[model samples]
Target: MRLAWPLVTGTAAMTGSVSVLLAGMAGTAPLAIGLGVALLGCVALLAQPFLGLATLAVFAHLDAVEKTLFGFLPVSAFKLLSGLTVLAILLNGPRLRRNIHDALREPVIVAGVCLVAIGFVSAIFAEDKAMALSSLQKLLSLLLLPFLVVVLADTPRRVALLICVLVATSVASALILGADFALGVQLFAQSDAATTARTVEGVSRSSGGSDYNPTTAASLMLVGVVVALSHAMETRQRRVLLLMAVAIGTGALILSFARSAALSFSVVALLIGWRHRHARFAVPVAGLVLLMMIAALPLIPAEYWQRLSSFFGGAADHTLGRRMTYNIIGLDLFTRNPLLGLGPGNFVHHFTDPEYRHLPGRTMLGRELHNMYLSVLVQYGLIGGAAYFAMLIAAMRHLGAVIRHPASEAMRVQAVALRFGLFAYLLVSLFLPNEYTKYSWLLPGIAAALHRCNRLAWEGA
Candidate 1:
């Protein structure tokens, strides 16, 4: 078997080399180079499938940057990595089947399927079939990501490595945003106009790469902060690195200038502090935080303070009033359909109806509902919304199980961290329609993987 494997790999490499050579001779050097690199990556992923997961983790945060760098190429880096990961998993047929079987049994997985199915059914009944189908296709593609994580991250070591990769990418994203903010440039911005125009008190908001707006970027940093803080508490060896991650993430979150994200992060921080109130380091950490806040007060931009202050109420602040208008429109739409919805992705289509045009709010013809739960309820109606919430509840329950029955201290710590991170995500969702975001599913997938790993460890013990 080993001999056959080597022979196959060697033949494939030789074929790829010849192909690249021919392409290079044809005056397509870039294409040839890309082909060669892709071939090498495929071989590596096949040899060690976990590398595929790590690569995906990196691209997930930097996809916009990848797109900018590889604009000449027709392929998407994120999609390519996903395809490669799937192929790598498929290489081991037995393991793939076993993982699928186990993953299917998870409550989160089941509920996720139900939600997708409901979406599909809603799509069939949508007013704009083309738009609905397109939206559904995207949702289905993203929905597969969590299941893929569950299948690939089977071991505790693999889970830990994946978490580290996520954290590193998050920190890298923060640094990118910080540099952009400092230089007054949008280094890896998804949209120049949006980035430039989005300012508060003359301070522009910074975004993470790859379709992440300020709110989404801030939410991502918030998750990283919680995860890093928890890891710092769990292990002494990597405390410095983890603490640095927390600091950088917090900085990025503030730079985002996203009021809801900031609020959610504050709530999570307080919750964490309260949870560990009796711990030995609690007092010291509280004192350190107080000192840090005092030291940072002067350094913090006036714009940030102004923006946060607007969160309460200000004559110049129209964000809250705008969101309220959107909510009223969204509710009206819900009342119109009340069941399967106007159909998937039809909210914007129906927003400008003659009946709604007379409403008091500004003309937000194509804007989203700005709330995840409201979006789901308006688009998929009660059934799909129920399934979506059920999936999240199931994921939280699974994480809670892991926390209550951890095989190791590390496992317990991770469970707590993930639960808080998930809570932060949910809290942020109240202000943003993030139902289709990758992290929304990835968090739950990691929770499920942790639960399974802990269960397996108990069985072995």
Candidate 2:
């Protein structure tokens, strides 16, 4: 009993640690905590039957705290995990930190840290105090995202597992979204109901704008497409099945009616075809294009069609008009506060009025910024934008290294395809805001892990 007691306690502690980490990375606390409890209960019931209750009680307490804190604080669980990781490093001598010496040595990390600092400092002079506070939260949220990526994505196995988890989440989210739309339930909140309704209607006709977010759904579908493509290249028997799944995901992306997603998918597909010269690849690609066109034919409203057509720079595309006007306002804001810009998240608050002088319907009252680059520029200033770009350049350089020296056939194909996928995402990001999404950090983190593993393979050779 005495020996089992220590074991039980240690197991409980470790389970909590694991739960905290998974919850931080995936943003799903209850599920992770449940798994942790199950693990603990299974262990305790076998050795110390009486300890099962105690373990359950501990799990319950943690779950309660998770529910309460995560509801109010988006980063509460993440901060807990960060604290735990730091504590572990302090105790265990920082072994993981030594694994990615190159990533650590890269100057981008320093620049990014400095840019984040400047963002906070600039917030003091922000035009609006409330806007500054919100911006501060956003800045901190985004800054922590990269750190989360670096800390959690330290190994190839972890990277693969992350992808698998995201795939599962995407699939589940799609199903939930479908059900919500069918049931006529509000499954998501959107900044613009009209945009959301149009996008959702394009994807699913019988049901629309359930609880699912179109942008998030679009991003997930993109991930599914990339993963399915990777799987098809590696697995012979499942190749067709994976390709079919990719088609489904692409179809879902179309249903999303996220113009940015459509643009991203098109650009990424072309890049992949050009990179590999796989003419057969065009078969699935062509199928998806046909599917989108077919879907768009009956479902897409005339206004949406007009909006898309007006993308070529015409008076009819009020969407472009809004974006162009936002850019002009963003530029004006940038010029005034060139050093720090309008706080970390205050650009919209400061520039929403007067900037839309021509359009009475145009208002930037919320966090919505159609363009990622302009949004970052207005919020973080040129200094922060430069730092962000530097980090991306470093990441791209690392990916380039992987393509030049792939460890295996699968690795080479995955690396090349992922590079194109990243490019696709960047292209999509041009039309929408995406620097703060979960996928944003996960992709780069996975890329970094792949890069590290390739180096290890080369060293072994």
Candidate 3:
């Protein structure tokens, strides 16, 4: 690993060692520790190509780190690293870097750009310009997400590094979350959810140790599972690493106890198993896959099965019923403002009004439409929805193409994971309005990067 990415691995090691030393330091030393680590990160940022991909591994922690940094720091350290990477590309401006150009040419990026443009235009008629722009800022920040991955993951080598970083982070997160729950401490420092809120009777039903919401933690853990599955099926080397990822991810996901996330995990597992069972493209990894799934099923707490059953009327509840109400309200909004809808960020503004709550079953309006797709349709209208779906469809199609191509078995296997990871997120998006989540935005980029790397390998580049 060190030989493959000397700069990134070395920088990561330095940070990890410094962090450990700082952890044991008695008092005021820890405050100064943050400054030292931030400086190390800055130095890493100067390494250009490796820096961009490495920053993504750290993205999960970057926001929290930004808040802890001293006021004298000029910018978001993560953003600064990303900006430096882009500047390095501009300076090098060479033929290989033109991979960025080709990456931009992917239909998914085109559709995403169209979607962003449509959202920006919709903001023009927004009820509140300031609020609309604020929402747009977040949306636009995410819209460039795939491009960020594309430029950094331009080569197969970098994509491998990206996967390594992602999987390693997931494993570390699991250890931290699990150990914290066992020790009854908020060991992650940044989660900061009060003792009562984070744990119930000393059992953590979330990644309470980390920055991710429990729901988001479930989704992240699902990502680890999917990637681990792909790697397990595709490669012979480091099978232990893959198994470790699967175990940790599953444990975290179970602790998260998110019904939709659990369902998504099961569906993705089944799909991968089925995909590999067919002889033409099918590999012989089905037995282990089935065993893994079967083992995972019993690990879930009994109450979670009850929670999943609620989705299908095992116990009719207000929250389940409210989703129906949300659908009705969303459709009504779409019908009235069909062309452009209520504009960006208008779902919450429009949905919370007393008048909207006058439905037969619903006495109170929902806080927001908890459905991301419906919310997008309500905000950006039909055109935006079309562009959004088009992007997703195109991305899915590209992955299929990559899988069918004659790349190395390893690339194809990982592509399988990338495809299913995106699918899992799509499944969970149905129940949560996580349209701007890093999970949703980052996936298309990773999938596209996988496809590009596989294609390059096939072409003998």
Model 3, 446: alpha-carbon shift in Å?
A: 1.6
Clashing pairs in 3: none
For each candidate in the order shown, give its overall lDDT on alpha carbons: 0.79, 0.56, 0.68
Report clash pairs, candidate 2.
Answer: 135-345, 187-210, 187-211, 188-211, 203-255
What TM-score does candidate 1 reach?
A: 0.94
Give the poorly placed runs of model 2, Cα more than 4 Å off: 1-97, 100-103, 106-108, 187-213, 230-238, 278-317, 364-367
- TM for every model, in the order presented, reads 0.94, 0.72, 0.80
**What tens-digit string does per-residue lDDT give for candidate 2 at 97-135?**
564355555444555567668777777777777867775
Which candidate leads the pack in TM-score? 1
Write down the RMSD of all candidates, one decimal each: 2.3, 8.3, 6.3
Arrange candidates, best TM-score first.
Answer: 1, 3, 2
Scored by lDDT, the top model is 1
| Global Cα lDDT for candidate 2 | 0.56
